[model samples]
Target: MARNRFDIDENLESPFDIKHFRRAMIYIRRQKKPMIVAFLLSALSAAIALSAPLILQHVVDVTIPEKAVGPLFGWSALMLATIVVSVVLATIRSRIMTRVGQDIIFEIRSDLFKHLQQLPFKYYDDRPQGKILIRVVNYVNSVSDVLSNGIINFILEMLNLIFIAAFMFAVDVRLSLITLAGLPVFLGIMLMIKTRQRRAWQAVSNKSSNLNAYLQESISGIGVTQIFSREKRNEGIFTRLAANFRKEWMRALRFNALIPFSVDNLATIVSALIFLVGLLALGPGEATFGVILAMSSYAARFWQPILNLSNLYNSFINAVAYLERIFETLDEPVTVSDVPNAKELPPVKGHVRFDDVTFAYDPGHNILEHLSFDVKAGESIALVGPTGAGKTTVVNLISRFYNLTGGQILVDGHDISQMTLKSLRSQMGIMLQDSFIFSGTIMDNIRYGRLDATEEEVIAAAKTVCADEFIREFEQGYQTEVNERGSKLSQGQRQLISFARTLLADPRILILDEATSSIDAKTERLLQQGLNELLKGRTSFIIAHRLSTVKNCDRIMYVSDKGIAESGSHDELIARRGLYYRLYTAQKMEA
Candidate 1:
């Protein structure tokens, strides 16, 4: 397998449905037994708490009137025992809640990371790296918090509300039902809050993504900013993006804070009205001191539960939106993937044939139109044409980076599409015009081409491309540090290292795309001799501008608008006086 990479595009088209929530719920339900136990424990705890007011009435009405200190001490001991039992149960329930919260957070984060692996390359191409990283890190982290503590608190709050209501009704049914009449109003206010919460959370997500993208773009081009003295201008843009981000954050914060506070007050208001109604419904004689006190305590206990429910609604909205974004990326169809039942490519002699293959990045503009050609095993072919005349496109197709729009390309007489992309590409090697320098030591970059190559083999490969001299000159030699994008090396030197890396792979097929363009004439002359040796017993495709490059090709296929307008050795093409002849003569005249 290739190195593990996390370059998924988080802004993929929304592929979210009810299915993601269903998956998330699977983890939520695992704590069902514990939740049920917690519910019962909380109910008992609330019952014990309600007994406090009742015990007070008992002490006043029964114990004091009896004039017995013995009975008072006995009643006080019972109260102490109830408190102790409730405290223990409450402690156990809290621990269970914590476990459930932690487990759900782990599940959400794990599922999110797993989904990222199946996303397509086009997703990565479309978004900024920073935005994607933030989604994987901060956004996922936030959603996990919503799922964990948010859901646990929500469940416990509902249990608390239910038990408190039951206790109130037991005290005085008429007063309990009448007092509960304001429940509809409480529900209505919470529903309105939920609507605003959804919009606020959505805005927060969008703004976060934007801010991350802006930061990434600014930092990546710090070189350009420093060169043009545009730091002030870039800073202004960043400041504006940050300001907008803060506005979105503040909007979410205000609504979330307002909803919980409003609900707390609403519960308080509801409880106050219930007390007045109870006093009216049960006249002074009918309402005992014990019953009235217990009912009042239940009403106040209702607020904590109500506020928790409101906060739960707010958190769930954010989690759902986050899950939707994650699902969008996961569902994106991988544009390039192995075909079902694809056969592994057998060992090949490196013969390549393009049979009427056609392709275009966009419709109505073919990069290669009905392009057909074949090169014998161990033969060298040069593709000479103006830029974007399908030279690199043809090579890219052969490497299976992009599929052909029409026709078939055969490697060793078998269609490339029928072969496993990995097996087919393993036999080919490429050296591009602009080399990519990955952050590592020089030795690490070279080993990237062939991981199993030995140290001696690596040194030999560098020597083959005449790169060993400069490499040895460095204090660390092969281990010399190469910064990200190979910034430490010159263009010519990077190209030389790329050549050495490719040569070490010992591929059956070799592709050189303007490989010699970056170096000086003296180095080019020296490398031309090395390329001649390397080309032997290998199928070679050379895309070059130097007229001298194709001099030794077995056969030259001169690419042009007309497609392979001329073919033959160097001498034969000059006789034709076509595109190749004209271009060749023009260069000599300029010199």
Candidate 2:
């Protein structure tokens, strides 16, 4: 399979669909109760606030002209009271929506992370790690406000527009029509900009994702960069990616900027037209001073919501880009999962069989074809092979990391495909070529193998794998903090700790692929001595390039050409002078 590099922008196969918004309704519905409360409070606040203009109209046209001082003061106090009440309600609504926004973010991120964990290794292998991290962390965060407050604000603005229009119509029909005459023109301009704006923002999202992917990859491989003395080259690459992101972001902002500019320009024109038409066209009799004042307030109020709607529309376009990426991750299929009728694997005596197994990472490119092998309950099998000869693939198959293209694998007379993954893998201990160490203390990392293991058991496992000697040299000993990938520990030390971790699991079947490749010969010898008891009654598969390492195994299989070419005890293979004998002799001469 072709793998994607950090610099490559991930292809978005589908165009922006209304379904993205519709799909968001699922997360929005989860917080409907809070949203409903917020909406009601917002509506109430808007309703109370609209009365301020009418009160001003009443004071200007009714009270002052008639010299009604008491009425003027009373209305003034009432207007002030309305302003306070509206502000309080709005504050309450803002608080509720903030909480709802955070909750929506949490749920989205949680779901995205959960789905990511269930995805097969192939899913991760195809994309850059940075791309996955950005979706779970950044993209999810970007859409929280859109999914929560954006939805409620959209509704509130629409309601506000309706209320303002109703008040204007009540004041004067002629002026109301004139005030609204600019809407069609504004909407036409928006329709023209709509596709351009969405496309630009989508570009922005893609550029940002690409930048993040490269940034993360560079950070993780910074040591490699310095070792190769390629800092300037990497810097140039980063500068190029950063420039692309900024360029796309600015382009999207330019389109977004036009929405408000169009709204404001049209609004000022309509406000001027409202006055001219009301005074000149309708005459003084139809347009009273109080009526004119109230209509002016209504016109301003009217355009305010329209401007808000334009901003919200901008937010939607931006958010849809993020939502597309987020939902895409959520929709990734779990290629390897338990069947509907799968059952938990029972405890076994460690009999494993590969029955004519055919497997491939990609279609028509079989790595292992029609291969059959069996190991008895307590036998030690060493797989010896050249690189790229299906050594690691064989071990990965036993763990069921990838689904088989053809054939079946059985453990203790039960098909592994019919077993739950957790139950199946829990009994097997696997140590791969890369001994990954997480960020934590030595004890904590070892305890990860058996969560319930006691401190004494952990120490014993470390001792059994010969890791205790080096661990004790640290000032913190078992408490020594290690960085991720165990950068502070030697390659051999990382392998020893990894070996200790595997032993702590006390697995029925243990697989070590290049388990001691980095360790010095003396340490490897000591480790071999320590493994004697651990291998007793436990089925083990050891893959090593060193012929001497496997000289004592019960059987050695020379794996090549998509199957085992030779299988026998070390002495028998040497006597036969076949592929295994030739390879063993070549290594012995090299030594």
Candidate 3:
């Protein structure tokens, strides 16, 4: 089956749906007070701008002709005040909208991060981390302008257009018609541009996601590239991905460039038509100099909004493409969640039972079939198997990492599925082969096992795992910072730190999946002494390739062909001369 990425469908009938646009507006709606203030300020600014032409007309037709100095002075001062008010209002509106836009971006990013935390492991397994990062960082930023400037400006320009047209028609109906004759042509051009630009911007978004994914993968595996001498080959792959991104970016830029050029030419044509009609159609005194000047101003104002809308349309298309990608991720259903009536498990006694359990990571391919096993309280069981024999799968099932497809797993006589995952996993500790060490001071990484652990307790846990001796050798001792993935530390040292962390948790049940594989023989012997004390009263399952590790367990199960083929202690298994005996002999011969 194909993995679900929750990607947007590029074949949607429209470039953008009203429903998606409305959903984006919900973030804007949250800042209702600031939005209201912005709207009012925008209206006031438009009104002030519209009054300029009327004042000019009055000065030319009445005030200047009358030659009354006092009245002329009053009108000039009034026009200057209007200009000052318009500038102030525009500045205030911009500030308010900018704040609102940032707030929306913050909320969306926070919510997306929180949602990702709630999603099941399967969700992340199917999607790339870089793609998820793009949604949180890049895509959210792309829509910032739409919320900050696009919506408000679109509304303001439409209102300006309506008011200007009303004033123009009220002054002279014939001239107003002549001024607007080019509007249909402008609309047709914008419609054509919108369709083509939407697809181009969508391509740009896809290419960006691809480039980010490839870059993240390459950087994370840089060690592999250097070890295998693949630097030149990997560079070729990165170059191709980057080239694809640039190609789509240029396609979108072409449409953006054409929009302004078309609007500018159309504006010029409309102005010329309005001038000719006013001159030829009107006789002397019928069209006064003041009236003609006012009409000319109205004609210019009319096309200005058209130009603004066309530019806004370009931005809207780009923003919507990113918005769709973000929303698609947000809308994915969380598949693994606690049932409504789930209850916390009581204090665990470390007794586990897997009754006829069958499991698979994907459908139709079973890893464990009818697997029944039981471990009494405080028992130590070791699982030994070949590479695909499902030894780790059994440990994962015990911790409920993945739900079983058939039968039941029980912890202390209670069905694990009926218990809250937190309650079940908190009492269990797992230490895997490649133990991940987060970047922080050694003390902090150990404290992650138990957040509220005291400094004294942390030191004691390190000593229990024989890690304190080596830890204190460093200049900073326990205060030493581990670089990303603990790269500064050796593999053996990393395992010792992880051992200290798990020991601090003090779980009732423990799982060690090849936990000692990286440790040198001398350190492994030291670690074994500490392990003996830690495992005394806990139910533990150890999966190890080293036959020596399993020799001391109460019982060893050799897993094969999707089930346990034999179970016995080391001496008994050796006497029986079964699979375990052959494996031990082969290992001894190799050594």
Candidate 4:
């Protein structure tokens, strides 16, 4: 599969469905108690609102003609009290729904984040970081209201329609039927526009996601863009993405506009028809002035609910686009998770073995095919190889970052696959080429590897990696603050801190993939002096292009063509004058 870059829009696999709305109902169902209370309050509020037209009819038909001052005051007071009660109930309902909305957002975000943490590297490799980030943050946020109040409002609006229609029929059947006549027309219009509107909104969501992905990528790589003098090119790309988002947004808005337009016009035409037909067709007794007044009020009230329902339907459509993406993240299979009833691997002595191991990142193209190797406890193994010879893949497999396509890896004679990932990985130290440093003080960064490590232990780890001298030079020593990804520090400084973190773990097995490449020659020489003591009883796997760095290892393996091509001590391999010998001679000539 092509890498999903910032500019690329991933194909949306989820179709529009009632099931998607039901899926959001899962989050809503969790807050059922508050939702029930809020919904009851809304129902009561609507009931109170429905009484207003009746009060108006009574005043116009009886109270005004009688000129009854005391009854008018009483009725007026009752109406005012109902209004106050409705407002209070509405306010309470709003507060409850607001809290419920926030809770749903928190829960969905937490679940998405937790699932993302368990997702394998390939999941990340196949998508833009920005796309993933948007789902967890922005998309989850967008669906919160729809999952909460949207569900409530949808049900409430239906109830309101029922209540309003019943009252209209009670006031006068003839006018009520006239008002009801517009509904089928309104329903037909909605049916005509529904699929097109949903598709348009989905397009808007896609464009928005693409824009967000590119924006995040550009921000993260701003330094590179400036260095390469590609600012204009990036800006041009951003402009196009932004324009596409706006274009899709406007197109969707046009569809959204149709909902209200259809409802409003239908309501107006129906209301006019109600008055004309009632006056012309109905006799004096049937079409009372008070009945016309009440029917007109009911006519407006009825369409209002339909209009609100249409708006809620719009919210649901837009929200499904985001919820689909959110749930998709939550549903992403954890390819590298521990098996059911997986046991914790006991503390290992690092007797590592690869038994007929076959692996492939992509199908039908094995990087390692039926390959095998072994390293006993306290051994230091160095892997030297060409660019794509699976040196990094070997270390990643040892950490169980990816499941093997076939065969098994054993640690201390126990199959690693049977072990819990946390237990296995916690006891092994794997440092990669890019050293990621979190935003925190120097001491906090070093202590991250072993969070329970004491201040003294953290300081010792830093000193062991020769990171102490430069850390002390800072104004606050170990307290010195760093920014995200350690942008405040040099690449070498970040690597040094990373080294300290790895050492603090005090693992039985250590895998360093070009760990010391960033450090200056002088600092590297000093670090090696400390690493010698650190490596005393640990089984180490080192991958470095710098041939000099691996010269002292107990064994050197030239990895290529799916397995080890050469294996021996430095001097022994030199004597053989094979693949390792040629590689060493070539580097020596360059030096």
The lDDT of each candidate is 0.77, 0.92, 0.87, 0.90
Q: List model 3 lDDT by residue over 1-591, tens digit each.
A: 232232322332334578888888888889889988998998999998899999999999998989989999999999999999999999999899889889999998998999988787667776667777888999999898887778888998999999999999988888888888887887787777777888899989887887887777788889999999999998898898888889999989999988788878877777777677667667675677788889989988998898888889888989988988878878777755567899999989999998999998889989999999888999999999799899999998887777788999998999988888889889998999888999999999889979999999999998988899999999999999999789989988999899889889999999999999998998888889889989999999999999987799988999999989989889999999999999999999999
TM-score of each: 0.81, 0.97, 0.92, 0.98
In model 2, the clashing pairs are none
TM-score of 1: 0.81
lDDT of 2 by residue, 40-71 (tens): 99999999999999999989888999999898
RMSD of each: 5.3, 1.6, 2.8, 1.4
**Model 2 TM-score on a 0 to 1 scale:** 0.97
lDDT (Cα, tens digit) per residue for candidate 1, span 538-557: 99988888878678888877
Cα-lDDT of candidate 2 = 0.92
Ordered from best to worst lDDT, the candidate numbers read: 2, 4, 3, 1
Q: lDDT: which is higher, 2 or 3? A: 2
lDDT of 1: 0.77
The stretch of ten residues in a row with the least summed lDDT in candidate 2 is: 1-10
Clashing pairs in 3: none
Error of 1 at 491 (Å): 3.8
lDDT of 4 by residue, 1-591 (tens): 533876666666656567776777788899999999999999999999889889989988999899999999998998998999999999999999999999999988888888889999989888888788888888888889888999889899999999998899888887889998888888898899888888887788788888988888888899999999999998899999999999999999998899999999998998898888888888677787888988999999999999999998888788878877776777678999999999999989989999999999989999998979899999999999899999999999999999999999999999999999999999999888899999999999888979899999998999999999899999999998899999889999999999999999999999999998899999999999999999999999999999999999999999999998899999999999998888889999998
